[model samples]
Target: MWEQIRANKRNSILLLALMATVLALLGWFIGRAFSPDPAAGLFGIVIALFVWMILAMVSFAGGDAIFLAASKATPVTKDVHPQLFNVVEEMAIAAQLPMPKIYIINDPAPNAFATGRNPQKASVAITAGLLGRLNRDELQGVIAHEMSHILHRDILFVTVAGVMLGAIVLISEIFLRGMFFSSMSRRYSSRSRSSGGGQAQAIMLVVAIIAAILAPIMATLLYFALSRKREYLADAGAARLTRYPEGLASALEKLSQNTTPLSVANKVTAPMYIVNPLQKKGMKLSDLTSTHPPISERVRVLRGMAGASFADYSEAFRKTTKHSTPIPSSALKDEAVQIRSAGSQKSADSKKQIRDIGDIMQKTAGFHFVNCSCGLKMKVPPNYKAHQVKCPRCGKISAV
Candidate 1:
């Protein structure tokens, strides 16, 4: 997780540089198009930086709220929706996480999301359809998936990405307005036109206008790519926690098959839901550049891990994963309540749920001895006490 954070930090810095450069270039292109002032390019970069900082602060404090409000989700109580509350609570305990605040959207879509500045302040919201449709275990799997995200501390980047979408758009609009005051468009130099070289300036102004139009579209695509990556990570995390990948796999199938889109879904909040808010219409993966991984792709990975034990999941993750830090037993420690928040704030009757999940853990015996995705299985004695157990069949060691 620390490595993911460091990488994210690096990525954020690089993206900021890229955004600033893009904005500056557009500004320069525009300035050259018009009366040709070299200073205007610098002005665009400065404006973009100022807005990025302000947007970052807003995202830290209020971004989640804006998304929730946009989606018309209301904070939920146990009494209002016990199924959701129960499912979330049980999953939180299973994942060893604090109870995140619960919310329910009135919409009939089966989707959910986790958000907050940090885990302690985190909130998870679900749609009414999610409760009404999925069965207990499947719902548990779905919520567990969201809970995994909280544990991973992956919220800020997502929320910040969402905020940047809006900021870039606002910046784009401001660029367009610059045309009204420019004097380069006049044939005969209107009283307001400051044309030193009239017709050539008009062409530059036109090109600048086109760049303003295209800027938001490009930024939206970048945000889309981040969401896809985060979804993959979250899916993998869920499989690791439940040790039953099919739970989430089945849930994704249901979500993908369902055709009821969330009524309150807007461009801004589209990335918050488990599935795209627009999924009911069966859009192509190419059309989806938001919060969800391709449902098909996510399901494929989870089903592959269904028979996998925690150790099995970790090794696969480790192989292609750049970050080699072990999944601290602490991170996977009971109920995800500690070992940090796990810092996953969840939703419910904490003690009872935690105890129940612990009992389940103890009774749900037999971990993957090989813990490999290569279709190898090895069973150990019930009382096996090795720090690492190597699978005799595949010779893979699942460590203590």
Candidate 2:
């Protein structure tokens, strides 16, 4: 795992540097277009780097909160969902990580994600639909997968890369939009073409236009590539941490069956999800731009595992995807782990679970809950003026 973490850091540096190069080039060219002076290009580079640094600082300071807020996630205490808290704690202990703060997204999509700059600052959010759908073992597997992201330091790279990608996209959009609404491109092109060394200036202008147009697309491809590989590693980590590939395999299958799109999901946040939240149900995500690997293939890899070890996962991944081993060779040198037996199956009352999750959300939203002696529960809205409320089911008066 340490080797993997180190490799991840190396990859992070390399990838971020590549992304920064793209950003700087775009900025330089765009700057050159506005001003033929070569020093303007340097100024553009400085501005681009400055913008990136600002975004990185913001992401490092509070990116997790922003993501959670975008997802409409409500923080939960252990009492709100003991099962989830216990599972998270259990996995944290197994992974030797501090317990991450928990959040529940009210969406009815069976998806989850982990976010933060690092392990100690990390947080995990799961959709209510996922909680209602997966049994305890399946839930544990999902939690373990997220915990893996924290353990491997994937969160920091993701946050920084996402911020970098955002900066790139933002600059490109602004430049293109400015060119469209203003006469900048035409003015610069005609002026340069009429001036001395016009040919070189014109060529540079063309190159800058191309860079502005393709920079975001290229950066996105890079981000997606990094995201896809990490998903496989996280799955492997989940398998090893839980010693049960079937749990995640089954959970992925169930999540795949859900078609509801997460309302809060967008391009910037989509890659962070356990599954690609933007993917349509039954659609195979095999394209280069996909934020995640094909769910079917991931499930197959997990189900095909011979043991609950990194070596087993790498082999399974190789056999299933026909790709090179996803796990680092050094990490695969550990002792073999025997897969654990399946946990006891209990009937899941999905409707009841959803109701309980809803109650948790309402509580977070300032709704007060009162238990009636007649076995009825009443939820009083925060704006209600009355001090007491009568249960609709039993007509039992209960003080708020």
Error of 2 at 383 (Å): 4.9
Model 2 C-alpha lDDT per residue in residues 1-400, reported as the tens digit of each score: 7988998888889899999999999999988987789998998899888999999999888999898998999887775568899999999999999989999887777899999888889999998778877888999999999999999998888889999999999998888788676766576567555456567776877788789989999999999999888999999999999999999999999888788888999998888999999988666589998999998999999999999999999988888878898787778886879998989976367677677667766765667778899887777787999888878887877888
Minimal lDDT window, size 10, model 2: 188-197
Compared with the true structure, what per-residue lDDT tens digits does model 1 show for residues 1-400? 4544455556656665655566566656655654457676566556666777798897787877877777777885564556678878877887677889987766556788888877788889877666556656667778877886787666776777666677778877876775655435643467664546667666777777888888777777777766666676677667656655766777788788778777887676676667787764656764545556578766765554423444444444454443452343333333321111111233334455444333222222332233445575444444777777766667776764
Provide the overall lDDT of each model, using Cα atoms, as 2-decimal numbers: 0.65, 0.88
| lDDT value, candidate 1, whole model | 0.65
How badly does each model clash, as a count of residue pairs? 20, 0
Residue 373 of model 1 has an lDDT of: 51
* 1 Cα displacement, candidate 1 (Å): 4.2
lDDT of 2 at 192: 54
